[model samples]
Target: MKATFGIKERLKSKKEIELLFSEGKSIAKYPIRLIYREATTEKNFTIQTAVSVSKRNFKKAPDRNRIKRLLRESYRKNKYLVSKNTTHHFTFMFLYTGNKMPDSIIVESKIKEILQKFISKEIEKQ
Candidate 1:
């Protein structure tokens, strides 16, 4: 099957996020903490990502929004690697635990590192 990402496959629902917190296994490697749960559906995976840029950090919504968008796009582009690697249904939550808003390249670099760790864990789980 051709693997592509969509809104439905991205974990955006509140219930889904809550479920992830309740049932997901966590993987942390600094800056990024991933929480994941097995998907019940046969043909889909979901991802929810959060970037921390609160009033205490950026003090502006636009800055936080931009960073969040960058994080999402980076994941959207690199997510194929994770999707193909998973043999069963799964959902992923990425929490940006950093104190500063990083440049896109930096975020992308951290994302790739985090994903590599995730892939390794999935391989070990097998």
Candidate 2:
């Protein structure tokens, strides 16, 4: 599978986003919180994700953007863990909940843990 995170892997539909927020189950790994649910639509990708950094925690736009960038990069690098051996399609929203900005290493490790937990949960549901 390609390791790159392309436009196809992003979660952008308004209806889907609303449904995800309204019905998705969430798991938290310190600074990161993942909200995910099995997709109702017949999408080709195994997972689609959105990243968020709250304005309350980060007052500056650049800070929020930086945090979001870090979140996306970490998720992209570790997404293969969730895609392997999975037949279901899922949508995820990753929220940055920490009061302070985190380095890439911290974000990546937390993202890895979150994805691993998500994969195990999905497996149990099968």
Candidate 3:
């Protein structure tokens, strides 16, 4: 698959977001946290994802947006790990928990690590 995060792969429904946070399980690797839950949706994609940066941590709109961008790009590049390993549909929220600014390399590595952990956890469940 192409390394793209298109509109269809985005999670935008309020009800779905609420359900995801309420019922999802999470895995964390330091500054990056992945909150995910199995979802039953009519969409064609295998996963729908959103990225968030805590306002409390960044304290500036530009800072938050930058981190969110980094998180999304990293996930966009590495999300094949999820698509290839699992058959279930899921909603994911990637939350940035650190207080300092992050570089692309750090974000990408952490995103890959967290995604790998998520895949391994799912395999164990099966």
Worst 10 residues of 2 by lDDT: 76-85
Off by over 4 Å in 3: none
* Model 1 per-residue lDDT tens digits across residues 21-119: 898888775666777877665544444444333456666788778877877877767877776686667777777667676778877777877888888
Task: List CA RMSD, all candidates.
Answer: 2.8, 0.8, 0.8
lDDT of 2 by residue, 1-108 (tens): 778889999999999999999999999999899999889988879899999999999999999999999999998888889888588889999999999989999999
Error of 1 at 18 (Å): 0.9
Q: What is each predicted model's overall lDDT from 0 to 1?
A: 0.70, 0.92, 0.94
For candidate 2, give the lDDT of residue 44: 71
On a 0 to 100 scale, what is the lDDT of residue 18 in model 2? Answer: 98
Deviation in Å, model 3, residue 65 alpha carbon: 0.7
Clashes of each: 3, 0, 0
> Residue 105 deviation, candidate 1, in Å?
1.2
- Stretches of candidate 1 off by over 4 Å are 1-5, 43-56
lDDT of 2: 0.92
Ranking by lDDT: 3, 2, 1
Which of the two candidates, 1 or 3, achieves a greater TM-score against the reference?
Answer: 3
TM-score of each: 0.79, 0.97, 0.97
